[model samples]
Target chain A: MRPFEYASPNSKEQVAALLGTSWEQGAILAGGTDLLALMKDDVVTPRRLVNVKGIDTLRGTSYQPGNGLRIGALTTIAELADSKDLAQYPMLFEAVTEAASPQIRNLATIGGNMCQRPRCWYFRSGMGLMPMTKDGKSLVVAGDNRYAAILGTQTGAYFVSPSTIAPALIAYGAKVRIYSAKASGSGVRELPLGRFFITPKSAKEREHDLKPDEMVIELIVPPPPQNLKTGYFEVRQKAAFDWPLAMAAVALQMDGNTVKSARVVMGHVAPVPWVSDEAAATLVGKTITPDTAMAAANAAVTKAKPLSMNKYKITLAKAAVKRAVLKAGGAA
Target chain B: MADDRPRKPEDNSGVTRRDFMKVSAVGVAVPVVLGSVMDAAAEEVPIQGPGKVPITLQVNGKKLSAQLEPRVTLLDALRDNFDLTGAKRVCDRGACGACTVLMDGKPVYACAILAIDAQGRMITTIEALAEGDSLSPVMQAFVAHDAQQCGFCTPGFIVTTTNFLQKQPAPTAEEIRHGLSGNFCRCGTYDGIRAVALAHAGGKQS
Candidate 1:
C-alpha cells in the first residue's frame, strides 16, 4: 500500500470534513477488508485514510416491531450472519454466511460491501485501472466474458454485481441511509437499497449511486409482511468461499397456499442486483407448485442477454430462481 | 493504454474466499470512539498523519511502541520491526488467514489491518501463545495428532485454533473443520487438524 495519512475521527461530521468533497483525495477505512486490497493492488491510491470505525453512532444492529430493522453501516458481516434477530431471515443469513471466509467477515462491514468495485479481471488485473477499454472500444465484448454481466451488457461495462447480500437485502425491502458532507441540512439521504447501485457507465465509473463524498451510514430493513416467506440460493463452482456464478433471492407474500406478491432478484448476472418484475408477476395469485416455480424461474431469465461466453449463466440463474422460490414457499 | 491516462485505482468489486463451513455454526459492544471514554477535560487533539507516526499498542499484554508510516500493515510491523515472525505473510490480502491475529479478542487478518489503525485495539499474535519451552494445550494437541506437514502454516493454525477453541470448546469434527477453514493447508492436513480439534474439544457434542 502507498503511504497515506490516517485519521480516526470521533464523529461522522469530522469524517465528512476530512473527506472534503471527494473520496479520491481520501478513502474511508471501515473494515479495511476491501480498501486495503484496493490499495495493495494499486487500484486506488488515496493520499489520506479516514478511519470511520471509530465513529460511535454508526454501529450496531437493532430491530423494532414498528420502526423495523436498523443495521449500522459498520456492522460486520459476521455479526449479520450470527445475529439472533436475523434467525428468521434465512435469505439474509444465507447471503452473509456464503460471502467470504469467517476471518474476512470479521473484518468486513456492510458499508464496504456496498462500495465494491467490479471484479472484472481486465478491470483488476492490469496496473492501469479500467483495462476493459483500449482504442475507445470494450475489450470485454470480444474477450473472455464468461464472468461478465448477462443482463446489462448492452453498454461498455460488463462487470457483474459482486455482492451476495445485495439481492437478499433488496428482496426484503431494505433501505440505506447515506451520510455525505454534501447533503442538505441533516447531511443524509434515505433511499431504497434496490436503487442503491448502478451499472458501470464507463469502465472507471463508480458502480453505486453514492457520491464521491458520501458514506453509507446505516441499512434499514422494513417490517416484513405478515405470512412472509423468503429464501436465498447461490450456485457456486466451489462450495467453500467462491463467488456465486449466479444466484437468486426470493420473497413471497403468501395468502395461505397462494402468493399475494413476490420479489425475485438475481445476482452475478447483471450490473446491479437484477430484479425481475416478470418473475415476480408470474408467482402472484398462484399456488407455489413445481409448475409455478419452473414458470417463475423461466421468467426470471427471460430478458438475460448472455455474452459470447456466458450462455451458461442463463441456465444457472434459472436454477437459482427455481430453488429460491421453492425454498421460500416451503415446498422444498 | 494512453500515457496521459489519469491514475485511477478502479474499484475492488468486493471479494470471495474458499472457506465456507459445511455444517459449522457461528463483536461485543465495542465503544465506537478511541477517546470517547477518556476524561472530558482533555482537549480533542486530533492526530492525522501521512508520514511516520508514533503509536503505542498493547500486543500480547505488553505496551509496545513503534514509529511507522500509516500505510504500513500490522503484519509487516510485527514481522519487520518487532521481529515477531510467528505470523507469516502468505496471502498479503485478507484471502488467506496466515497472518491471523486476535484483535480485540477477535481473529482478523493482520496484513489487512494497517499498523496505525490498529493502535488502540488489543492485538494478540502467535508469539504469545505459550510459556518458555511449554506449548499451549492447542499446540500440544496439534503435535499429538501430527497435524502438520510443511509447518509453514503451523503458527497460523495454532493461533486460529486457540481463538476457535476458546469460542467453541465442544465443537464436533465437522464444526472443527469448518472453523479452521480460514487457514489454508496446502499439504491436505485437514484430517489431522480435525482430529486434533476433536481430541481437545473436551467431549461435548451436539
Candidate 2:
C-alpha cells in the first residue's frame, strides 16, 4: 500500500473538501473493509483518505411510523442486521445478513456496501476497473464470465453489480442524500437510490454515478403500504464469505389474495439493480400461487443473455426469483 | 462538536520532533516517551518523508507510539513495530480473516485497517489474551478438541470465538457455525472447532 495523509474530519463539508479531484487523489474511508482490500491489491492508490467514522451525524437508524426510516451512512452492517425493528422490512434484514461473514459485517458500513466496486476478477486483478480489449472487443464476451452480468451488457463490459443492499433498498423505495459544496451553496441533493449506479459504456468509466467531491450522507426509505410483503433471496457459490452468484428481492402489494402491485429487482446479474418489469407485470392482478411464481420466474429471465461460461446463472437466477416470490407471498 | 476545536501545543503531552528538539534545550531528560529522544542533541530535527508520520496509539492497555507510514496496517504494526506477532497475515486481504482482532469489542480484520486510522479506538491483539504459562479458555478448547493443524489461523479463530462465546454463552449448532464463519482454516478443522466452541461455552455441560 502507498503512503497517504489521513484526516478524521468532523463535518461533511470538511470531508468533501479533502476528497480531492477523483477516487485516486483522496478517497472516503468509512469502514475500510473494502477500501483496504482495493489498496492492498493495488487496484486504487489514493494519496489521501478522509475518515468519516468519527462524524457524529453519520451514525444511527431512526424510524417514524407514517414517514419512513433514515439510515445514517456510517451505520455498520452488523448494527443494521441486529435491529429487530427492521423485521417489518424483511428484505433489508435478509440482504444485510446474507452479506460477507460476521466479522466483516461488524466493520462494513451499509453505505460502503451499496457503493462497493465489483468482484469481477478482471477488475480486481489490474486489467482495469472495467476490463476490455484494445480493439473494442468484449473480454467477457467469450471468456470465463461465470459471475458476469447477464443483463444490461448487450454492447460490452459485462460485470455483475456487487451490491447486496441496493436491490432490497431499491425495492423498498430508498433515496440517498448526497452532500457536497461542489453542487452549490451548502450543496445537498436527494437522488433516488435506484439511479445511483452507472454501468460502463466505455473502458474509462467508474461504477457509481457519484461525483468525486460528493459523499453519501444518508439513505431514506419511504413508508410502504401495509399490505406489502417483501422477501430477499441470494444464491452463493459457497455458504460463507463469498459473493453471490445470483440474488432477487420481491415486494408484493397484496389486495386480499390477489396482488395489487409488485416490485421485483434482480441483482448480481446486471450492471445495476435490474428492476424486472415483466415479473412485476405478471404478479399484479394475479394470485401468488406457485404457478404464478413459476410464471414470474420465467418472465424475469427473459432478457438474460448469458455469456459462454455463465449459462448456469440463468437457471440460478430463475430459482432465486421463484423463491423470492413465494417467500414474499407467504407460501414458502 | 467540541472535538472540532484544535488543541494548543502546550496542552499536549506529545509533540513533533521539531518541537521536542526545541524543548530539549531547557530540560535534558524531558520525559521518557515511547521512543528515544536522547538524540535531540544533534541540534536539528530530521524532515519526515512524504508518507511517514508520527502517531501515538494506545495499543492493548499501554500507550505505545511509533513513527510509521500512513499505509502501515495495524497487523504489520503489531507484528513488526511492537513485536507482537500472534495475529498471522495469511491472505493479506479480508477474505481469509487470518488477522482478526477485537476492535472496540468486535472482531475485525487487522490487516485491512490502517494503523493511523485506529488511533482513538481500543485495539486488542492476540498477544494480550494470555497470562503467564496457561493459554486462554478458547485456546484450551482448541487444544482439547485437537482443532488446529497448521495453526496459522488459530489466533484469529480463537480470538473471534472468545469474543463471540462470551456474548452467546449458550450457542446452538447453527449459531456456532454462523458466528465463526468469518475465519477459515485451509486444513479443514471446522468440525473440531465447532465442538470446542460449544463445549467451552457450556453447551455440553448445560
Candidate 3:
C-alpha cells in the first residue's frame, strides 16, 4: 500500500472535516479489507486516510420490539451473523455468513461491503470504471465478461455490483443513514438503500450515491411484519472466499397460504441489486408452488442482457430466484 | 439538509513524479487541516504520517513498540519489524488465509489489517499458542494426523483451528468443513487436516 497520512477521529464531524472531498484527496478506512487491497494495486491513491473505527457511535446492532433494526455502519459481518436479535431476519444472517470467509468477516464492515469497489477484472487492471478502449468501445462488451452485469448494461457500466448483502437488505426495505459534518441541521440524511447504488457513466463518478465527505453511519431496517418471510440464496464458484456467480433475495408478505406481496432482488447479475418488480408482480395473490416459484424466477430474468461469456448467469440467476422464493414461502 | 461547506479543489493531476514531490514538500499540510477541523472537539485528534510513526501493539501478551508507516500491514509489521514470522504472507490479498492471526481472539488476516489500526487490540500469533519447548494441542493434532505436506499453510491452519475449537469444541461435520474453508492447502492435505480438526473437536474420525 502507498504511504498516506492517517487520522483517527472519534466523532463524525471530525471525520467529515478530515476527509478529502474527492477520492484523491482522502479516503475513509473502516475495515481495510477492501481499501488496503485497492491501495496496494494503486487503484485508489488517496493522500490521507480518515480511520473512523475510533468513532464510538458507528458500531453495534440494536433492534427495538416495536421499532426497527438499526445496524451501525462499522458492524462486522461476523457480528451481524452472530447477533441473536437478527435471527428473525434470517436472510440477513444467511447473506452475511455467505460472504468471503471467517477472517474476512471478522474485519470487513457492513458499510465497507456496501461501498466496496467493483471486482471487475477490467476495473482492477487499471482500466477506468467504465472500462473502454482508445476508440471508446466498451472493453467489457468486446472482451471477456463472464462475471459482468447481465442487467442495466444500457448505461455502459458493465461491472456487476460486488455487494453480497445488498439484495437481502434491499428486499427488507433497508435505509442508509448518511452523516456529513458540513450539512446543516442534524448533519444526517437517510436514503433507501436500494436507491443508493448507481451505474456510473464515467471514471469521475462513483457506483454509490455518496459524496466524498459523507459517510454511511447506520442502516435502518424496518421491523419484520408478522406475515413476512424472507430468504437469501447465492450461487458461487465455491462455498467460501468467492464472489457470487448469481444470487437472489426474496421477501414475501403472505396472507395465510397466499402471497399478498413480494420483493425479489438479484445480486452480482447487475450493476445494482436488480430489484425484480416483475417477479414480485407475478407472485402476488398466488400461492407459492414449484411451478409458481419457477414462473416468478423466469420473470425475474426476463430483461437480462447477458454478454457473450455470461449467458449461463441467466440460468443461475433463475435458479437462485426460484430457490429463494420457495425458501421464503416455506415451500422448499 | 444543504451542504454549505465549500468543496476542496480537486487535484486531477494524477500520481506523477511532480505530484509525489509536491505531496512530500507539503507533507505537514494534511495534519494542519485535520487539526483545524478538529479544534472544536473535546479531545484533540493527532494525525500520523505518510512517514514512519511510533506505534505500540500488544502481541502475544507482550507490548511491542515499533516505528511504522500508516500503510504498513499487520503481517509486515509482525514479520519484519517484530520478527514474528509465524503468520505467513502468502496471498498478500485476503484471499488465502496464510496470514491469519487472532485479534481480540477472533481470526483475522494480518495482511488485510493496518498495523496502526491493530493498536489497542490483543493480537495472538502462531508463536503464542505453545508453551516453552512444547507443541500446542492444535500443532500436536496436525502432527498426529499428518495434516501438513509442504507446511507453508500450517501456521495459519493451526491458529485458525485453535480458535475454532475453542469457539465450537464439538463442531459438527458441516461446521468443521465450513470453519476451515477460509484456509487453503495447496498441497491437498485437506483430508489429514480434516481428520485432525475433527479428532481435536472430540468427534469420531471418519
User: Which one wins by lDDT: 2 or 3?
Assistant: 3
lDDT of 1 by residue, A102-221 (tens): 788888998889877667787666423234444676677778889988886666567888888889999999999998644788889999998998865655567788876679999999
Candidate 3 i-RMS: 6.1
Docking quality of model 3: it rates as: acceptable
> How does residue B189 of candidate 1 score in lDDT?
79
User: DockQ: which is higher, 1 or 2?
Assistant: 1
- lDDT order, best first, reads 3, 2, 1
Task: Judge candidate 2 at residue A182 and give its lDDT.
Answer: 49
Which pairs, if any, clash in model 2?
none
Range of the 10 consecutive residues with the lowest summed lDDT in candidate 3 chain B: B1-10
lDDT of 2 by residue, B139-196 (tens): 8878988899989999999889989888898899878878898999999988889989
Candidate 1, B86-130: lDDT as tens digits: 999998978778899889888888999888788889989888898
* DockQ scores for all predicted structures: 0.28, 0.25, 0.41
**lDDT for position B49 in model 2:** 24
Please give the lDDT score at residue B42 for candidate 3: 28
Query: What's model 2's overall lDDT?
Result: 0.81
For DockQ, candidate 2 versus 3, the one ahead is 3
Q: Identify the leading candidate in terms of DockQ.
A: 3
**Tens digit of lDDT per residue, candidate 3, span A1-332?**
66677778777776665675676777999988999998899888887898999888899999987778999999999999989879778898888988889999999999999999999988887786898788888988989988889988888999999998999999999999998876888889999999999988776788999998899999999999989998788998887778989999999999999999999999999889999999999999999999999999999988989888999999999999999989988878
Leading candidate by TM-score: 3
Higher-TM-score candidate of 2 and 3? 3
